[model samples]
Target chain A: MTATLAIGPYNQSERPALEESFNAHVVADPSEAAGMDPAARSTIKAIAYKGHLPFGGAEMDLFPNLGLVANYGVGYDAIDVDAANARNIRVTNTPDVLNDDVADLAIAMWISQGREMRQAEAWVRDGKWASDGAYRLNRKVSGGKVGIMGMGRIGRDIADRLAAFKTDVHYHARSEKQTPGWTYHADPVALANAVDFLFVALVGGSATEKYVSKEVIAALGKDGVVINISRGSTIDEDALLDALEIGAIAGAGLDVFVGEPDLNPRFLALDNVVLQPHQGSGTVETRAAMAKLQRDNVAAHLAGGDLLTPVN
Target chain B: MTATLAIGPYNQSERPALEESFNAHVVADPSEAAGMDPAARSTIKAIAYKGHLPFGGAEMDLFPNLGLVANYGVGYDAIDVDAANARNIRVTNTPDVLNDDVADLAIAMWISQGREMRQAEAWVRDGKWASDGAYRLNRKVSGGKVGIMGMGRIGRDIADRLAAFKTDVHYHARSEKQTPGWTYHADPVALANAVDFLFVALVGGSATEKYVSKEVIAALGKDGVVINISRGSTIDEDALLDALEIGAIAGAGLDVFVGEPDLNPRFLALDNVVLQPHQGSGTVETRAAMAKLQRDNVAAHLAGGDLLTPVN
Candidate 1:
């Protein structure tokens, strides 16, 4: 029986790399592990994991000999870290490698939403430019006030990029950071009110679930735009949907949702919102880096070295 | 008779400001001036012009007392400068004010095309994410090589913005510019070949017509993306269409087209392109500034002062 188990529907390009490094057993999800022979499950010492499915103690119990679970993404919200800790199982996630791609997407979405590039493109493709005379003038994005929620590594990266565009950067973090010139808001609602564009860059997990609440969304105002590159759980999706539907907020550029891939159907009808399939770090370069980090963590655990990026 | 003629269809918001500033006669186009009574035509000393219709010596002849043509846009290509010079007419354009908006759009378009953001948006909106799983990974835009075809003010602004993203900024100009640290290629093809993204920001006129020629486009290679915020005539549109059709180049983000407003229908069919209706400088703030600048130039000319932004 293979000592390693790789889970999730990884693509052809990613599969070869995992196969080369480990004698592995591949499964689509945790349910598949339950169906495996008892001896085969007992043999699994490490799990290479991806996807947003919850992996709790029940799944860990199925693999009696499981030692480590290496997550493919920066966010380890789906991995039950507490359960892993209780079971004396180690957990690690790929981080930092995807910061540039996520930051780029956040900035791109902000510009796209502000400039109405999606609708502008459709207007040209539909022959409206010739018949319609001129495309409607949009709002300027640069030199505007920008607020970043959760001044983590990704948040700082986004703020850095926005600073280059000459935007007045504001942020809300757990505590005051040493960032010079950037205004720090103790409250998220205050940060939202102060900015023309608000970017959600908080981490995932229960602590940050619905961190951007109804009050925060409302404070952003009618001229404000929201750009979320963080997990969908960071925002109160119902409040966001209502704000978008009635024009309480000018627009939203969402890369994540509360139940994404299976995101709310209401988002499908919005012309003001630029929707992306939770692809903040879905770039060839970034994904490759993330995969490498995930494998490195697993390799370190197997070789009796420190876990590369431990969560538990 | 009015001292100024505000030509082209001015919006309600803009028309009031012009009327408040000047004793102005508003006409739709050059042909409308021809239809006006001889007294009205002869009385027109300054024309506050907008639109892409040809305004030449023939049009200038109608306004026997015309001293100034204060163009509402930076590109005064539609107004023949030589014709204005032959008739001893001074031409002024609103420049510098619209640079930030245009540069913003160029950067937005480059990021959009490189990330395949249009398709990514549709994939999420059309419920493909749930059915098709994750959207395919796209190319990362930041930290790539970017070429500026013309290193003028707007181009320099674009380079400055791209530099923040850590891109290698290379440029081609008639002569070497004072841009320290940025690579300068004497030849356009060489510049194109050296970059992943090419931005066209040259001034519009016959001298620069087809400046981004077929050779330059080909040299950009298959992984290269072209972003044009300059005038339609700056690029060889036919060659561009062919390259896009055959996948000879990766993609294009075109805000201007040959004979646009009436751009080629072939562009509509291509998924690799992101089309914009030449709204590079079309922003509420920027347009207002442009209108104010145009009015200022005319006011200066009417008061027997030097033209604010004279073309010839």
Candidate 2:
């Protein structure tokens, strides 16, 4: 029997991996493939969705007839695990494969801000260095304090990178950690006050919404820097701006945002912040590996084996 | 017996140090105190002169009676060393103390560019990270190659910083080095081609005029970055602009310029560089330490012991 498979928002990079593991491919936009419209999505027997469609979308109803849904990456926010469970449809996400890449990007962001890298590049590329001189007023990165928000795999990796700088690492989490050389604070506020640089690596959604608010930002104080590789909603944007304008905090480095594409105009004016067009897991090596893992998950589910990375 | 002293641009920071060492303090702007104008020079019995007048306007002939002239810092470009030698005035320069501080700024610039730091800061502080949704873009620093233009103490310290990054250190010097972990390249062009990043730590003078010319810049190609913390005059400014415009080289970090405080407007438009106000050794800690060292050198000279850091 030929099993029908619905492809999600993932690009062609995952094509080979998908073909290798699945029998029949239904390459449609997730919205269309998940029977977005009652009449359109009834054709698919199983689904493989990616970045499109939130977990509570109309497409989730199709899971009743679907056997499995393989997510493209570790963040399975777009797929509804609860709905899939009720319908007996298994859901899986690619997690372990992306840890290193995300961690590497996170570290790169931290160093980039600590060193004022892009400005350095502009200095030389603009010939200001040759004309006026370079690094005449640069800052130091060694012996700086690094605070990690959310103690997890990626956060630990960032700490590893900080070791080279001889930096002190502090972590803020719901629970305290017993890790040596790492000081644990009860929350982000206490942690922000004690560190020179703060990094956010926790999960997204309501539980963490606006966790870094005015109180937390004020604790960071002047000369303090923040880096967010976690969800943007965790931070209070308005509070952060107030801190930056009044010198309550020094600067920040971010890879995630709230409204996104429709970014805030005020952010465009600040030189203390660094901007990137989100591509954390976009590395050639990491993206390919993630695609492969998703493929493997699909193969395992079809072969009557347990899903590799189930989204409980 | 009265003694005269020439102080060239020596601010309050250097005053205390000089007072501790010298038995008599007769301060003259080096340009005027050195008797630059025969008619303006005072026929003092004995005096010490500073290297030069502020902005090169002072007449050096203010104090003709000076027996000893102590150089403040490593570079003696403002002092007429030949004239001092003719007068049998012993000249001393404070060197070793400031090497580590300058080197720290240089390496910090290097790593900042390699990591694209300024952009990262802009992303977060500007709140773009929160508004842009998801994004990840930063350069890696761990395994890149490092090249030094001059193999001096500062260059050595820079190489030491590279140890953590696991970089292969290469240097272009007048002669080969016996230092470990550094391979010497006799020519600047060869060195530029052999490394991912090139750092200029060479002295500025006739012998090293425009050493980093268009030829050397071309050799670095598109992927290589150049960092100059030594002196602006050591590089060919015109050549650097051309290279940057054509993308012949990736980027640069500069702390010194040919004619500073009057930066080129051309550089103001580029987005690939970092600019500073030439405060490499501006840190409070480093500056104080530098002042202390100069003072010690002056004290040793006054006591008739050999100068601590004599240039000749």
Candidate 3:
């Protein structure tokens, strides 16, 4: 039997599980696979993948026996699904398993930004609290109007958590969901205008690219805050940067940014924003679950069983 | 009729309301009242008070006609309630009005600490994410065991919010209340042992001093996070500092501190902790509501009517 290929940088703690599950041929990137002998490459039947590097038809053509691409995270925008479908190559992504973790992070970021927690922490750390008496008052998060873009599984989870805080939840989706009492707006701008806080929870793809446009951001008004736990491509980075620079919006809590890890340097200069690395689903338990789900999909595919969570 | 003394530094925006409501005599501090004529001081009957300064019989004695001490915040720890009761002076505090804000902070702190948001933010801001790839995985907050130190109004609010996040809510209170599904432990240490996150929401005072003791801190074990939204006196800061310094516990999210603004400098050195200035109830909406309630109490007392939300 051919070995399964495990791609991306898996830390010491996580790599063992992959090694135990399969006769794994680990590579840092797809290009590295080219260095291997043709016979070994031909033997690759499955790939356990992580990271945001684009893996398209070109990479797919490398392995003639490739049957499965088990993605290690919920969002698999990096995987060219259309190309995989054309080749009858199955692609499975870890989804619902990471919903709670991502939702938790979105809610945390919203509350943290609203409460000005970062600045408040600095006030205490710098000993300004003692000399200054009380820190300046911040905006209240509870009872505020909140708008969620894309009412998917993770979006619903974020809404559920916000509802507990007594927020009036509003959302913009392809179609109105079955959630009662939550106001639905067809236009994203209308949703933005109605909310003091707008959370981006749309899926990552060209269809949703720049969905949170300049008009939508401007509609949020001066006191409004934007929170993004979704893919960075869902927002227009230039518009967001401009708005944040001039204080057009109150602040933002961003976990994802366009070309993140190498996001726009301008974001680093803003004190009004709370910047987080793309870590919405970065938790030990969630990541472990994701890795397990990814591995399980590969195992099932090799056994000629049904793919667990097929994206294609 | 004498004027009501509005103490503490009320900003221009808030001062107008106090002036409009009372024949107001504004003073920066209690000692500043000494500059006033005896007639003016003797005629003062009500105080619209803010700040952490202790207000006892001695201060009350300055104004022979003093009948009401209207506190502008929820916690009345600094006000000598027994002395007020003995002097037949009515004491009122702003409560319930700030419950959501304080509870929001407590919940936010819990999630922030568990998710390691502060460090995550730094990873993005400091350009470590681009250089170091993905930030390290953090502990999941949802579905974790949570402990509330006191089951007061704020504690109940915290529990209600945590329940929505799927947390197994555990608490230590004076006695069990009517809360269903939540596990209550009579001993604080037992409660600490049962939870991954412990929140301090007890009332402030000597009676509850060091309520979260060294034993409770140790019982929390490793991977435990302490979140304090209550008074700093509720926890043994020395024990907490020791635990944080030695990695005895995972981390802490603290809003209040012992001698805050001048808190133990050791906290600033620790990267694992998220320190916030005492601003749990410091939101514009809540503070405005608190000020209104405080003024309402003073107005009621002046009219020989019932004091609103009276402590004594």
Q: How would the docking of model 1 be graded?
A: high
lDDT of 3 at A223: 89
Which structure among the candidates has the greatest DockQ? 3
Model 2: how far residue B166 lies from native, Å: 5.6
To one decimal place, how large is model 1's interface RMSD in Å? 0.9
Docking class of 2: incorrect
Across A1-312, the per-residue lDDT of candidate 2 in tens digits comes to: 335465654555566556556655655575455445444455445567676357553565653456778888776666766777777777887876666556655655665565565665556556665566434333455567888888876677667656655578889888887676689898678898898888888877667888888887888888788788776688998888777766778887776667664556666677677665455565556677777787777778767788888876
Candidate 2: where is the Cα deviation over 4 Å?
A: A1-53, A56-59, A63-141, A151-153, A172-190, A213-215, A263-312, B1-142, B151-153, B156-190, B213-215, B261-279, B282-312
Task: Give the TM-score (vs. native) of candidate 1.
Answer: 0.98
Cα error, candidate 1, residue A21 (Å): 1.5
Worst 10 residues of 3 chain A by lDDT: A1-10
Please give, for residues B76-191, the per-residue lDDT of candidate 2 as tens digits. 56556666666665566657666655665666566556545566555555666556643343454445677899888777767776654557889999998877758889988999
**What is the two-chain DockQ of model 1?**
0.81
| Model 3, runs deviating above 4 Å | none
What's the TM-score, to 2 decimals, of chain B in model 2?
0.85
Error of 3 at A52 (Å): 0.7
DockQ of each: 0.81, 0.16, 0.85
